[model samples]
Target: MTVTERRATTRAAPGPRPAQPPRAVAVGVPRLLYVLALAGLALLTLPVLALLVRADWPGVPAAITSPEALSALGLSLRTALAATALCLLLGVPLAVVLARTPTRAADVVRALVTLPLVLPPTVGGIALLYLLGRRGLVGEQLDLLFGIRIPFTTTAVVIAQAFVALPFLVIALEGALRSAGDRYEVVAATLGAGRWTVLRRITLPLAAPGLVSGTVLCFARALGEFGATALFAGNSAGVTRTMPLAIYTAFNGAGVTQDSAVALSLLLVVVAVVILVLARAWKPGGRG
Candidate 1:
């Protein structure tokens, strides 16, 4: 080797080495924290366990199959399904917009979109009523032009459910989109793919895990909607009443017994548990 190359290699070898990060220190969890966490868990779960303890297990079938119960269950399922469909239709596009927009504008839009999540159900119901009631802003115009009434109808049930559930899908899908980054989209665009093609092929596929979990959450939330549905749609048996409304009615001694309410409540609890299990399965690194 030449003398110059030898000298350069020797100089480089004696240069300062790069710094290494310190190792993580293992910290022990406090016993108090553990105790508090256990308490919190119990606080959330005890009510459900108590409900099971009191439920009329043998009478569940009879209560669930009663004509009114059947009508409420059917209505709940149908409306929840419709609400979920509506969520997927509008929420996907809104999520994409939130994902791609500038930070400031996105924050504003996201806040507005997620408002209903924190808003009380009764407040939401009241707001919906004012906006869509026969004498309301847009409702009055509709009444004059098309003679269409919105509140206290089966359609109001769907609207209330969708209003509350939309944020679940939007928040989930947006998180997925942000995590996925824009690398693939940039490549697709450079390859001459249009925005629609890129979204259809790359964005949605990458966000599939979030989409599945979001859809499940949306459906579950819609299924359990009560205050909004009660206020906006009323408690019409064949048209508007859902399982939660039925349970509320029975609990208040309108016509059905407390046993029937407990049974229907158990059914809802079961549906919630199944949905949570399904959601866990669709998480990014989950079993499914």
Candidate 2:
């Protein structure tokens, strides 16, 4: 091409000759917003500080390590672990259905799955009792057919914990699944991957953060369960009286002293903090 024609073409094509202003790197936070945020943080943290201040520090070890406290702690740990497993086994599938299905029925089902979250723990306990008690509809049939009773048993504690905690797993994982989308799953399917393969390899891996977070929440919630477990499982030491129930028993003067209750409460709070810290440090595939 001629030099003049080449020069004209270069002018026609867009040029990056204009000098641009540098962007400001610093951002100013409003004083009012910072004050509000600090207030919100203080609201959450003050109670923890108060509990620490009021606790009998010298008696903590005795209170937590006493045979009765040990029994209750063991029971709480076992039941909470069982409930977390149950949540994962059931909640994962339910979350998948909720996130993947676009139908109105899915919405209804999601709300139903979330019902226990909004319901008072006592109300949930009562509901579970009616549904699984000796005279209950299914409970009666089970008793008539197999002589199996569920209420006030160790199993009942697990059930109560699972009932309340399942929603946490379901909600967290569902939100994760929905946000991650299904394009990758579809692509994998087009490449001859089966549904299970896609889920195990793609969907779940992508949502592992949410799954881990949900599991932590489930475990924490189950460990701290009180009202529902009290009503549905009955506070029978070693069998169903978990840490919360033991704490209650102590606080109410039925068993250990108030110092014991305070110690147990502090222990529970410590465990929750540890779980959260561990969760934050976890890295999926060493990359997350």
The clash numbers for all candidates, in the given order, read 0, 0
lDDT of 1 by residue, 137-182 (tens): 7888888899999998999999999999999999999999999999
Compose the digit string of candidate 2's lDDT tens values, residues 70-147: 999899999999999999999999999899999999999999999998899999999998999999878889889999
Model 2: lDDT of residue 24: 84
Q: Model 1 off-target regions past 4 Å?
A: 1-26, 254-256, 282-287
**Residue 170 accuracy (lDDT) in model 2:** 96
Candidate 1 at 130: error in angstroms?
A: 1.0
Give the TM-score comparing model 1 with the true structure, all chains together: 0.87
Q: What are the models' TM-scores?
A: 0.87, 0.90
Model 1 per-residue lDDT at 206? 94
